[model samples]
Target: MGAEENIGGVAAILRPVAAVIVSVSPSGCVELRLPSRRRSWRCDGVGSAMWIALRQHDGRIGEASEMLAGIWRLDPVDVRCVMNSWAAELCDAGFLRLEK
Candidate 1:
């Protein structure tokens, strides 16, 4: 199955896994660590921004996309697509979980 299918599409709610450790640098770099899985992921630039926005918006993809779209002056639909894709990646990597 595809990432989108696994995540139940763009409207899916996502939250960081409770056991995962997250850290952000002043330079907008993000690090996610799942000690149980012995896995870690690092994000910078747009990825970092998206992660921050996702957390700020309480895992609401639409709200995060809107915030990014406005700041980047990009189409909302395009921003949403990017956000959804990124979210799916994070979910598959086990740093995030689907809430609904």
Candidate 2:
């Protein structure tokens, strides 16, 4: 109903659809062998939002969160929850920095 919900809905649909093009399979998997998706990759809530948000940002969590919040009119607190969780996961995975 709101812009945030619209953005989230669009994101929810687009990412999974686009993930077909978004995902990389460099493991020598065959054209037919690649999975539609893995069970573990499905996520929800702020964590899922964060994951999609960060991936869409070219890996820039800060700008992604700000843009995501602005475009969606979501509360900063909610946006922060998405971003912080994403940053934490990325950091744990050795993919992102604490400050940036």
Give me the candidate number with maximum lDDT. 1
- Candidate 1 lDDT score relative to the true structure: 0.84
TM-score of each: 0.85, 0.41
User: What does candidate 2's lDDT look like per residue over 7-74, in tens digits?
Assistant: 33442221222222223236422111114444223234445456566667665555567877887898
Please estimate how well model 2 matches the true structure, expressed as its whole-model Cα lDDT: 0.47
Cα deviation of 32, candidate 2, in Å: 20
Residue 78 of model 1, lDDT score: 91
* Deviation of model 1 at 33, angstroms: 0.5
Alpha-carbon deviation at 35 in model 2, angstroms:
13
Q: After aligning candidate 1 to the native by TM-score, how far in Å is the CA of 12 from where it should be?
A: 3.8
True lDDT of residue 81, candidate 2:
67
Least accurate 10 contiguous residues by lDDT in model 1? 1-10
RMSD of 2: 12.7
Q: Which regions of candidate 2 are displaced past 4 Å?
A: 1-41, 93-100
